[model samples]
Target: MDAHTVTRIGSHDKDLQELFCDYVPQVFRRADFRRWRAWGQWSDDYHAYALMEAGRVVANTSVMRMRLVLEGREVTGYQLGAVGCLPSHRGRGLARVAMNAALDACGDAPVLLFANPTVRQFYPRFGFQPQRQTLFTTTYDSVPEGPPALTLNLDDEEVRAGLVALSSEGLPSTERFGARGYATVASWPVANGFARPLRQLGSEAWVFAGVEGETLYLDDVFAREPFDLRAWIPRLIDRPIRAIRFGFTPERYWPGAVEAGEDTEADLFVRNLQLSPEAHRFPIMAHT
Candidate 1:
């Protein structure tokens, strides 16, 4: 630790922010941090704590300010992501140092993160308890008769502007444990092509979804007002999806016997807060 310098750079810090962005892709091959930063939606609330060896980043942890809806109440929290160290820097406790700095900055606020399966044992050392998340799933019979939802390309300035406007409304897709700021964290996935934005013709609602095989993963929805999602699901999808999985709780909008399953992608860990798996699941797009 003595040979390295610990620095925290916010989104507003251009030079240091660029340094962090340049270092991230080396660790996360799919991360387009440079493009996300240039998209102009990078919130100052997102901060990166990095261990710099001379002028290059050796290890890093990012803390993103999140507005979470917990059990129907809106609250503030911190989400940690982009947490890793270069291979040369491993086994030196640099990652631990960066995590400590990030947690310290959060103070008493609830902190959460989605960690890779390989590092499942590391977070508990810092009081982060492994938590379960509910994945709501349901089966559909057939594709309804209507125009398929249009996939809004993020590259278009008009589509980007529309998403920003919808997100500024600041509505949580679900009242039971979801995210408030839609475009804040969601833009990363859209910009990186990890997820696509879709909308039905003559509708104001927009959906962020991912597809695999015959299943559609409905990550999040941005609409000015609440509507019956169960009915809208058919119109929202283009191809015939045999199953639909929701990232957020669906009890409010879609009130049917949707199977509640466990998340298999990444493990969720949190500190200073109790997030119940059966009660609510964090919005998928809100993940950093």
Candidate 2:
């Protein structure tokens, strides 16, 4: 094996893109790579660092600036994402190298991230601890009963606006909206492998379902009221769907709507980031 020298570079740098093009394919499919690209646009607001050995990328990490409105004031913070390390370079501490570079650039703003189950234990070395658990709710038997009708369409522009609106309503403290939110919703139609005419329930409610294999994934549902889970539950159950998966809706927001089940906690995990006293912060909105 050849000895490798690791170098950290910024994502905005031209060489980083070349290295990303080279290394992304080695780890993700074309579609996944594109999704990451979309996220990069928003995630890039803070800064990105990549670990390179000779001319090839071995690891990568990014930090995005965020503002949260907490307790009636705004707080600035950082959200971390786009973390990866090539398999061949896993054991060489390249991930640590990339993260340290990002932290140095971040200069002590509170940082946050939602980690995969596999890597939950890996982030604590950098002063991260479990803060909160994200919950997912699905209902099969008790769908919405005569809820207000909504016309739901998956237009890129509408989806973008919907997300921005949701962010404003939910995360009023944040000063910037990153591309990850837009890209995730924009790529939903194709990535989840389903295409259907926009579904309209009424004037104020709309639902879009993403079907993969045998499961129907409710990618996004829009409604006028934040507490109107009843309206959208029927939209999902109306279909001949075997199962449904919704992401990042905590119990506090929905109250008694989310019935506890085995997969009820499917999205449950501890967030390891905290907000600094100086930065304005608000409740984290789960939008993926």
Candidate 3:
């Protein structure tokens, strides 16, 4: 391993980093690579660790810093992702070294990430533990007049940015648990699933979501004040939305809404469980 040198990288000439993706096709496929590259919302504090061997990238890991509100108090956290290592470089301890560097930089800040079943045991070495998050769904027997709102196009950058900024007022937002999509628009639907932007008129708040079959899924929601959850199902879509589902847990409850069931996010692990139940839905567009 002494022959290798690890370096921290930022958003510069992304071309050079393509080698990392190419080396780990199974980790970051063609589409996933493109999604992260073109993702609109990127933190200036983005951090990626690269292992250089013979002047070539041999291993890598990316750390994303996010602001979260835990139990009504603001705190900083890290979302570690994009763990990759070259197949030819196996047994060289590249991944362990790279992850150590990432965690070291993170200090005592809490971290969140999802892992596949095969690699599930790998993360426990870092003190990550699986936790159950709660998400809610319910049927709307009749259409009720929702909040005053209008839909926005994905390209509505200025208005969308402003709305997102306004929406991030509260901390500890999570998908399927009131997790807002302020981290990145990609989080709106996660995996490039269907998504639509909606603005709660009077409050100037926003939400992005999509529907399939009879269920309407709220990918992300934002508001300066507590948003009327009932407004989400009725006002946003025209079809007969029989069921409304969301990752967010609102301050107030809707009349007919009830806790339908719970979903287990396999491989989703966290270190230091200060806050909880941010209904952590698997991000459709989030590659990590």
Candidate 4:
């Protein structure tokens, strides 16, 4: 422990970023952090506080500074992520050291994080209270179908550029609780199962979604201008879906959607903000 030191690194530090990325998969098996960084999606908003030994990251907690919409009002906030210590470093309080440094860097901004079950008890020690999110869902009904949505690959330079522009101007899916300026962070979902991207309304709108069984999971949507989501949803459906589950609050888009129950997001914790149950959900794709 005497040889350990904490270091703060941002996305601009290629060497340190690589070290963090290499350590990430050891904790988060499916996070393609390196690939995401290579795509140039790691923005300056993200920073990592790492406990280093001999210049190698042994424990880390990353933060993403963001503009969050809380109960329809905009506020500055931070989302903590990628928090873990190497197997050998666990139980030595190294993770706590990294987390404390990250939280201090947040500088009083409301902070939130998703924790794994294993660390559910750890966050509460840092003034974080568990917060439950609402799951919005609605029964699917048959509608007049249009041509299927065209799949746009993010790998395509033109498509990526278009998305970036739209993301900068797009309205939050829900004013209750969501994020602004989140284009780069969204690449995580694009790499995960929600790989399909669809653009409509002359490419002014885009949707990221995937299907499982009789359900269509709408991961995220971006549009330069507010549009009729209910009316345009029928056009986006290519297969049968008896129900739709939204990854973001649906009050602004689909007024008829009902609160199903607690969202799948477990072990969620927040500090310096009151997030009442069923009020709204932090947009899924916006999770750091």
Candidate 5:
């Protein structure tokens, strides 16, 4: 016989908050929780449902509110984050309990998550189908005129808003608009000075990236002007940059050296179709 209680804890629950904060570094094992704690930013809108056993959190899953747009219509959904169970708590189905509780709390909104390839098969049983993203690659030499560049400093609110402003430049094509009201922004910072600022051509280029190896992978891009991304490739590098990659591609197509392919490098699994899968992409900047 097992006895445990399930509770949804937000920032207000001080004691459980401390316990969960301690538990994350243990289960995740790879991320720097210290940086996350140092940020000192907590979202009351994000909730973690945990299985409490003997006064300790054993299994947990976080649920986040998402205000999405599908074909220009407003839609609501939720994103699942940091789902795991303590090593000793495995095989106990505590994760399942926490997940179900999250879904119920979310009512009927769709639930989405980015899952690793190894555990990709686990979400389907819970009704999480794979969502596809379009990828673009190109190697170009033409240096075309483009919107001036602007450095995206996470420390600066204006810069962050400029990044968010790109979502509304013309029409809502991706999921950044859905994340407008949510403070769940999380991303790998621009490092090594491969690049400093996210370039913009009058709100055209919504991007953040640093080069690695010889390839300049734009952490993400959403430039709808003229549509051909190859024209903007040359502007991305100050010294020398080789091939370019898109973290997320727009539904519209662009000509030139750019090549397109449907890929699964980053997998999004959704339990509900609250947001249509057609030409859908959650921007890299909106990661939680």
Candidate 6:
């Protein structure tokens, strides 16, 4: 076998699709190529590295640009996700090569990611430290009281579009849409194989829910006035749901004024290549 050649590439090209198909089976049990394409479409902060053997892609990883706001200030950082290597290429340091290239390209920005529990120890080798632990919160009885007067449809394209638009406004940091600035939250379900659910409350606001089995995952729950848990809680009450799991920030709104426990901390980590005086001054979540 010839030595693998690793190269940095743009996410907007066909090579990305080839990389996805080559390693989808090893990366996700249920990979949605359409959603992945959507992700690339909405992502503004994407840096991808591919490992090729004999001109065929065998491993891939990406560092998406993200924005984080803290103390009324915005900062630029990188969120590491979509890291994978083909099974045939594993244990050959292909991941390390791809990651090093990514880090080199990142310059001085702080890097962060939610590592799978299995690979927790692996990231530390690259100087990633565990900064926080997150939680998945759900409520069966928290639904607001109503007679189901409002129509609930999870498959409406308009609803999804609304949710996507709201995400950019409400949660700017996590929004991944438009060009190479950030990836829009709207593309999650289509990319991740999760079903999107829409809840409309008289045009006041809309919430998009992604369902995986009995668990309903809320991705970019957009609503004005802090969202009334009572109104939407009832939406899931009668359903055969085991629970509702929200990503990252659940404390923002979940009915009954539930506080996001300390367990839900965003684990901040860093991998420095060329640290500068202003590197530490850059807001951690600005570009996340």
Candidate topping TM-score: 4
lDDT of 2 by residue, 1-288 (tens): 122334444445655666665776575444233443443432444355777667777777766665533333555666666577888878878788887777776676656665556776777787777543322445434433454334444345565556445444442212221212232333333333333334444544344554454444554443444445444555544435444544323232343335333332212221333323331212222222
Error of 3 at 265 (Å): 4.5
**Candidates' TM-scores?**
0.91, 0.61, 0.77, 0.93, 0.75, 0.69
Q: How good is model 3 by TM-score?
A: 0.77
Please give the TM-score that candidate 6 achieves against the real structure: 0.69
Model 4 lDDT tens row, 28-143: 77875866776788788898998878667889999998888877788899999989898977889898888899999988889999877777889999999988788889998644
* TM-score, structure 4 vs. true: 0.93
Q: TM-score rank, highest first?
A: 4, 1, 3, 5, 6, 2
Of 1 and 3, the candidate ranking higher by lDDT = 1
Worst 10 residues of 3 by lDDT: 171-180
Most lDDT-accurate candidate: 4
Task: Select the stronger candidate by lDDT from 3 and 4.
Answer: 4
Q: Deviation in angstroms for 228 in model 2?
A: 3.2
Q: How much is the lDDT of residue 27 in candidate 5?
A: 87
Stretches > 4 Å off in candidate 2: 1-15, 28-31, 35-46, 68-74, 131-140, 143-158, 169-227, 240-246, 249-253, 258-288
After superposition, candidate 3 runs with Cα above 4 Å error: 1-3, 12-26, 30-40, 54-56, 142-151, 170-181, 185-203, 251-257, 277-288
For model 2 the local lDDT of residue 83 reads 70
Query: What TM value does model 5 have?
Result: 0.75
Please report, in order, the local distance difference test score of every candidate based on alpha carbons: 0.78, 0.48, 0.59, 0.79, 0.61, 0.53
Winner on TM-score between 2 and 4 is 4
Point out where model 5 deviates above 4 Å. 1-3, 32-34, 37-40, 142-150, 156-183, 187-206, 221-235, 252-262, 274-280
Give the alpha carbon lDDT tens digit for every residue of 81-164 in model 3: 778787778787888888888888888988877666678777889888875545567775435365635766545567546655
